[model samples]
Each structure stands twice: as C-alpha cells, then as structure tokens.
Target: MTQIIRSLDEIAPNYDVLFCDLWGCLHNGVAAFPAAVAALQDFRAQGGRVVLLTNAPRPQQYVAAQLDRMGVPRDAWDAIVSSGDAAQDAMFAGAVGRRVWAIAQPKDEGFFTDIPEEWRDAPPITRVPLDEAEGIVCCGLFDDLTEVPEDYRGRLMLARERGLTLLCANPDVVVDMGEKRLYCAGALAELYEDLGGTSLYFGKPHPPIYDLARRRLGLDDNARILAIGDGIATDIAGAAGEGLDALFITGGLAFDQFGPDVENPDPARLAEWLALRAQDPAYSIGRLR
Candidate 1:
C-alpha cells in the first residue's frame, strides 16, 4: 500500500479526482458543513474533478438541488451520482406489469417523480403499503421498529415467494437523522434477504455506484482519485474496492458509544483508530478549510 501522508492542504495536488460522500461528509442531511464545502471548492480551483457519490436513494439532480439549497456552492462538485439513479436504471425502462410499492418517507418520493408515463396514473409508484404488491422498492425502513405491524413482514415474504425483485435504493442500515437515529431501507431489505429473497443494492459498497463515480470524472491517465466519506463500511470499503485512495472523515454522522454525538471528532481519531488496529489511511487529520 502506498501511504501518501495526506492532509487537506495536500489533497488536491495529490489527486486528480475526488469522490466524496454526501449526508455525512458535507452535510447532516439538513445543513452543509462550511469547511467541507470549501475543501471541494479548493480542489476544483486546483483543477481536480469532484464527484459526490452518495447512497441517497434519489437521482443525482435531486442531490444537487438539495446541496444547492443548503448553501453548498454548485461548483463544489463537478458531478454527482446516487443509488436512486442506479435503481431507476435497474427498472428496465418501466416495463408493463412492473410495479414498485415504495417503502419510504414521503419527502424522498420526489426522486420517483420522473417515472415514465407508461407505468401508470395511480402515482406511477405507490407507497409500499403493508399488503399486496407486485414488488418492493425500499427507500427506508419505517422509523418505529415496534410499530412495524406483522402484516408488513407477511407481504414482503409473499412477494418474494412470488419471485418479486426487491430493489434497495439506499443501503445504509441507519443514518444520523439530526439527533435521532432513523432506520434506512437497507436494514429492512437485509432482513428480507435473510428470509430467502434476493435484493438488488444501489449505493456505495456496491459496484454500480463506484462505476458511476469513475465515469463522471472520465477517470484515467493516472489521474489520482480520492474517495472521502464518513463511514468505514460504505465509503472507505467502497473506494478501496474500486482501487481509489480513500480519505475518511471522523467528524460527521457517526455517534459515540453512548449518548448522542454533540460534537464532531477530528481526523486524528481516524488515525488513532487505524493505528490501533495496525491499519493506515493515505492521509490523516483535517485537510480542508
């Protein structure tokens, strides 16, 4: 492994493309991190392509709009790719008799607004209600686990036995929803798979999302690309799997062992964690302004 001894100051000169994860890295899904936004701007000013790769189960456009509204400079990213776009692609151009009972919060349904006209007029995609459906497309798990009626589980299994394909838009088990830890669709989809059903996953730690990340940059020519994210399981693992340098952010979505995370931990904690486990990241500590 080639260790680069990186800090935010040295990130851009060191890499040609930077693949960053949204939600945890740049924003808390509700606001943008000023320093995080500045880092991308600095990288772009230095001639690097910035691609924000996210597990958000919405199309790239939606991600861009959200960032734009949050004061994230539009040019901070050269392009964006998301798990939602991948799932939409997997739908095979809206074939007849195909339906997806969307199991997610209402706000995220906007991602499906661009569905084809041929699909249907009953909202193209209906909420994945706890009953019969042709197939399931999970955007997120319902927040209250205890309130998840048994009827919901039955329908999932029934659909699976009938050979329905359960497509997962976002694959994270949970994301820090402000101060509350809300469940994501990935958790429910995993449970379904455990019951002998197969699932199509979109997002980081999955192949398609990374492929999109590379494509957006037209990556090649020894153009070093760095993937920066806040999670070990998704961003770091996904970037490493795709043979890209990874910069892990320790100051975002993740919570400490007890209570809520009131403050963000710094990059030194990332180095300490890696060193304690005899692991190493190409860079260490905060690199962005």
Candidate 2:
C-alpha cells in the first residue's frame, strides 16, 4: 500500500539518494517552486545526494543553463542526468545513421552542435531533409508552443515507408508548461509507432537513461535511492522499473484527480486512481514539501 505523506522530511532519512524529476516537481517551466527547492536543499544539507533526473531532451549543460534561467538554484541538487545526454551518446555512436533529419525547435539546436568532448572522434552528424535522411532525430516538435503530433503525420508516413528509425530524445508525451499543456518528442514518437514506424526512446521509463543516471550518481548499487516526480508514466514508472522507491507528486500532472485541494490530496481518490493505473508508489504527497 502507498502511504500518503505530508512532506519529504517525514521520510528523508530512509533514503541516501534522490533521483528527482524537473518539470512538475521542481519547477513549472516558468519558475522553481520554493518549497520543492527547499526540500531538496534540506535533503542535501542532511548529507543525502540529489540527482536531477529529467527527460528534458537536452544535454545536462543546456538543462543546467535552463535551470539557472528558471531560478532553480544550483545548491538544491548535486548532479543532473538528462535523456538528451543518453540519446546523444547513442546518436554519436551511430545508433542512427550519420545523415539524419532533425525535428526540433531553435532552442534544441544545441543538441546537435554541442557535441561533448567525448564525442569529438565520433562520426559527424548532418541534418538533411526527411527525403534524404537515413534516420530521424526527434529532439522535440519544431514548435511545441503551436504544434501537435498530428501535424507531422504525412512526413512520418514517408519515413515509415523508408524504414527509417527515429531516435526520440525525450520520452515525455505531454508536459504542463505552466498553465498550458504542450506536446513533446514522445508524442511524435508514439504517433510514428502508431503509423507503423520505428521509434527508439532514451528517456524515463527506459533502461538507457536509468543506467546513465546510476553512473552519474556514482553510488554503489546498495545505496538506498528514491525517485520523486509528478509524471506517472515517465518518472514514477521509471522508478518502479529500476526497483527504486517512488514519491508520487500529485500536484504536478494529476492534481485534478485528487479533488479541489491541490495541496492536500483526497486519500480515497488518490488510492482509487493509483489502483486503476496499477501504480503503487512507496509514498504520495500533494507536493514536494
């Protein structure tokens, strides 16, 4: 049974490390949550390490820059492991062909150009038109603010016909960007699979990202780890797959299902919802606090 808790302090001593999600738990795209920030800071002060594990589809440096821009202080967490970092490793290793088609926004262009020092000897990757590409690299939608997955059905169909494998950078289908929900790279990847195309994911709920996170954590396998996030499919599911305890944040994506009080989730409703989904997180909280 999952226990609904009031704050992280109640259970902090049980775990030595935290694999925290970024989007809904720590920040809401626009700004960092003060309570969530403080909770993580407090965890570190107690000698517990915090790793910001995210499916942001950008390298850790860029994600760190984004956090800086979003007012998420550096002291709140110890390290960051991003899906982009994992996917980039695969891409540079030629998991997909050298000449590929890129589906991303201007902000995501850094994913292609900012090759880490480690990948310097790897084959050069060039972005070509869909018709001329050997594989597809999906960082995100070209315009997440104004586009949806269906917008690329025709193009995806052509790629399917060619048997091109799509490398999905982010495996989050949707995210609440403040008050607006936006489609992500995973949405397009899902659509591609639905249309008889192949899509590869290197994000949450996938083994590759988790493997990379463990390495970044630099902890022994025996270290007690907890995963805290609002994404049921990505963060929570990923934690479950990795045999890590999960702290489900109800206030992030599924706030409405827990009744009108966002800070105090309805226990019965939360129980029923988790039962319906067959997810038994170790603990549940309205927010990170």
Candidate 3:
C-alpha cells in the first residue's frame, strides 16, 4: 500500500537531498506553483539540498531564466541540471561530428554553446536542409504551439533514408502547458525510431542524467535522495532505477488519469495505474505542498 502524503513536511527529515522535477511538478508550462516553491523553500530551510532535475532540452541557464520569468523563487532550489547539459557532453565527446542538422526552436540554441570554436566548423550547428548534414539534433519542435509530431514525418523519413543518427536532448513525450498538452522533442525522436532511424536520448529514465544529478548533489551512492515528479515513466522510473526513493505528484501529468480529486485519489485506481508501469513510488502526494 502506497502512503498518500498531503504535505512534504511529513517526510522532509528522512532524506538529505531532493531530486525534484521542474516541468510538471514545480510548474505548468505557463507559471510556477506557489505551494511547490514554498515547500522547497521550507525543505531548504531545514537543511535539505534541493536540485532541480528537468528534461528541458535547453541548458540549465535557460531553465533558470524561465523559472525566474515564471516567478519561481530563486531560493527554491540549490542547483539545476538539465538534459541539455548531458546532451552537450555527448556532443563534445563525439556523438555528432562537425556538420549537423538541428530540429529545434530558435531559443533552444543554448544546447550547442558549450562546443568549443575549434571543435566546430564555420557554422557549429545548422538549421539548414538535412541533405547537407552529417547528424541530427532534436531539442524540440520547430513550432510546438502550431505543430505536432506528425508534421515532421516527411523530414524524419528523409533523415532515415540518409541513415543520420538523431540526438534527442529531451526525452519527455509531452508536457502540460496551462490547460493544454504540448509535444516535446522525445515525440519526434520516437517517430524517427519508428521509421528505422537511430536515436540517442539524453534525459530522465536514462542513467546519464541521474548520474549527473548525483554528482551535482555530491551525495554518496547510498545517500537517501528523494525524487519528486509527475511523470510515471520518466520521474518515478528514473528514481527507481537509480535506487532512490520517489514521491509521485498526482496533480501534474497524471491528474487526469488519477482523477479530479487532486488532494486525495482512489488508492486502488492509483495502485492499478502504477502496477501497469511496474513502478512503486515510496510516497504519493497530490501536490508538493
């Protein structure tokens, strides 16, 4: 039986580090959740370290700026680690050579800022035609608001025919933006894989990002770190794979499936849902507060 927690105060002392998810748990795509911020502040006040681990395809600085714009308190977290950081490491470590095709928004160019001048050719990362590219880097949809994954079928097929390896910076398929659900870079990557194309994903549910977070937190291998997030496949599964405790937030992406009672969900239904995914979160909460 999973314990349903209404307040994080109940388990704050049991863990030393918190690996918190940003997109759905801390805020919707539009704004910050005040209670979630307050909870992290209170946790930090009690000497617990909070690290924001997100699947956002952009660099940590970009995520910080977005958090600031959304009015999330600066003190709510101690550090931020993003999938883009991991992807940058992969790119520099010879994941993709000089010339590459980029399928991302203009604002997501921060993923390539870490590449040194000498390592890259004239144009480090190009958004030009795929035919002139050696590899592909997908951070997000060219236009997420107006486009879906299906819109890129033709492009993906072309890349597949050329046998280009696609590096997916973000592994999340969808994220809740206000009341609407937006497709992420992972969706496009999945489509590419379906078309017999090779894809390298760098994000949650993959061990690399968790390893980065563990190093950032400076915690021992056996340290009690609690991961809190809404995505069952990404957040909960990632934590479980890392052998860390996870706190499932039902109010985020899983709210609709879990039901309308954000504060209290049917235990049987919740258990059944988790069982299907083979995940067992240490604790379940409606919201971070």
Candidate 4:
C-alpha cells in the first residue's frame, strides 16, 4: 500500500524514534535544510528520541561537528552513528595489533593511524598487492572503486590467496556527488568477495550499523521510526529492511543521478526507482528545506 505525509508534524504522533537521514533530507553538505532542522527540533521538544543515522564515511563526531557548522543544533537530535564509526570499529577489531593493507585516499589514511604499532600498514596499490597483510581496510576508492577495471581482479585474488580479511569503510556501490555518480568502496569489496576474499562492510542499508543505533537510542523494535534520506539503496533499503518506516528525500545523495534536483524530487519516478531495490519508504518528501 502507498503512504503519504504532508508535514513533519504528521510523523511525531506515529513515531517515538526518528532515524533521520542527513545530506538531502536535512541539508546539502554545504548548507542545512531549514524545514528538516525545524522538524527534528520539534520532535525532540515533544519528548521523542531523534537519532541521526547517516551513510557518511566519516566518524559520527565529525559528522556532528560538520552539521553543527551547517546550523544543526546539538539539541536537534538525541545521538548519531555514521558509516565511518562502524569502519573504525571494524578496523580496531583484531586489526589494532595486526597488520593491514589499505586502499584509500591520502586524507583517509588517518583512520588507520590509530592501529597498534606492532601491525604493519602494507603498501597500498589501487589494486591488490604481492605482499601480504593480516587484513585489508578500504576507505575511499582510487579512480573511484566503483569504476575498477577487469585487470584489478588479479590483484584482489592475490590478497585472497594470502587469506587476508577485507574491510570496506563505505558500503555504498555508488553515490550522488553533486554533479556525478561516483563509485564507492563497497564495489571493490564485493569484487574481492567474488574473488574468494572475505569482506566486511560498515555503512547504511546494513543491519549492523542500524543495530548500533538501536542500542544507543534504546529504541524498541515496535517503536515507530522514520528514516529519511536521499539514497534509495542505503538509507531507504536499510531502514525498511530493519522494520522501520522511511522518507525518501530526492536530491540528497543521488540528487544528480536521478534528475535535475534532489530537493524537489519526482515522487512517481522515485517510487518506481525504489521498488527495484524492494525499498518502500513511507513517503517521498521534497527535501528538508
């Protein structure tokens, strides 16, 4: 059945916990969506718990600080959990004292600096390497992991033969990057798994990250949660899979990929779009602002 909501107020009475999406649903990376911010603020004032759930590949604290700068008040929500947090947790899990091979941008290497000194930071290649490491942790893609070539298969296979565990910081296959659709880390990780390498992913649309939010927010399974986001694959699919209602914000993540604007999305197209992924978020909202 189809569902619709005209205003944020309509959501409060139906939900005790709100698992809102960032980016398009709340604001563009550079600016905050005013309507979204107000809605969240109203939710908290009514004694509801608001947990900001995002697929961002950065830590939750960093995301919070960035949002704060964009005008999201500290009181806007109860807590947050980002894909990056899960990546960090997985990176530290047994990986703290062990060696790891990473394929990420220069800026992203810091995520691994916290690893124990005893382990090694195996030399990085856009593709796999000849030398072995205890595990592999991926953050961003080189040439965008989404567009990797057939040749890289051999490199991934080499890592697998060595039996190294693989880590994917961003579990997105692709994302709406303002102007273009770019590949994400999960694409390469999937290939590695197909190559016989073991891979672990941390990000949206995944049950683990959602599970973490469940504990932090103290939200019961029966709680009516509204998850709003831009990406149908991660935000909508993940939340729906977890038995929560969701709102699809058109222009946030895949704004450019789908059409002209994410802020004002075409609901008919969106509904059909998400149906392919089996994602049926409760409503299709224009945007936060």
Best model number under lDDT: 2
Question: lDDT at 139 for candidate 4?
Answer: 75
Give the per-residue lDDT of model 1 (tens digit) for 142-244. Answer: 5434334243577678777877767888888777756666667777777788778877887888998877666766776577888887667777777777777
Q: What's the true lDDT of residue 14 in model 3?
A: 99
- Residue 23 in model 1: lDDT: 76
- Stretches of candidate 4 exceeding 4 Å from the true structure: 95-97, 113-130, 142-154, 194-196, 254-267
Model 1 lDDT, residue 249, Cα: 65
State TM-scores per candidate.
Answer: 0.80, 0.99, 0.94, 0.80
- Colliding residue pairs in candidate 4: 24-252, 251-262
Report the error of model 2 at residue 183, Å. 0.3
Superior candidate under lDDT, 2 versus 4: 2
Stretches of candidate 1 exceeding 4 Å from the true structure: 1-7, 93-97, 116-132, 142-152, 255-280, 284-289
What is the C-alpha local distance difference test score of candidate 4?
0.72
Local distance difference test, candidate 2: 0.94
Q: Which digits, one per residue and each the tens of the lDDT, describe model 4 over residues 135-169?
A: 77777576663456354687788888888877788
Residue-level lDDT for 26 in candidate 2: 95
Q: Write the per-residue lDDT of candidate 3 for residues 1-289, one digit (tens) a residue.
A: 5688889999999988899999878999888888999999999999999999999998788999999999998889999999998887777666865578888887987777656444565444544568998889889899988899999999899999998999999999999889888999999999999999999988998999988888877878777799999989899999888888899998888887777687787788899998888888999998888
Clashing pairs in 3: none
Candidate 2: deviation at residue 33, Å?
Answer: 0.2
Better of 1 and 2 by TM-score: 2
**Residue ranges of candidate 3 with Cα displaced over 4 Å:** 114-127
Per-prediction backbone clash count: 2, 0, 0, 2
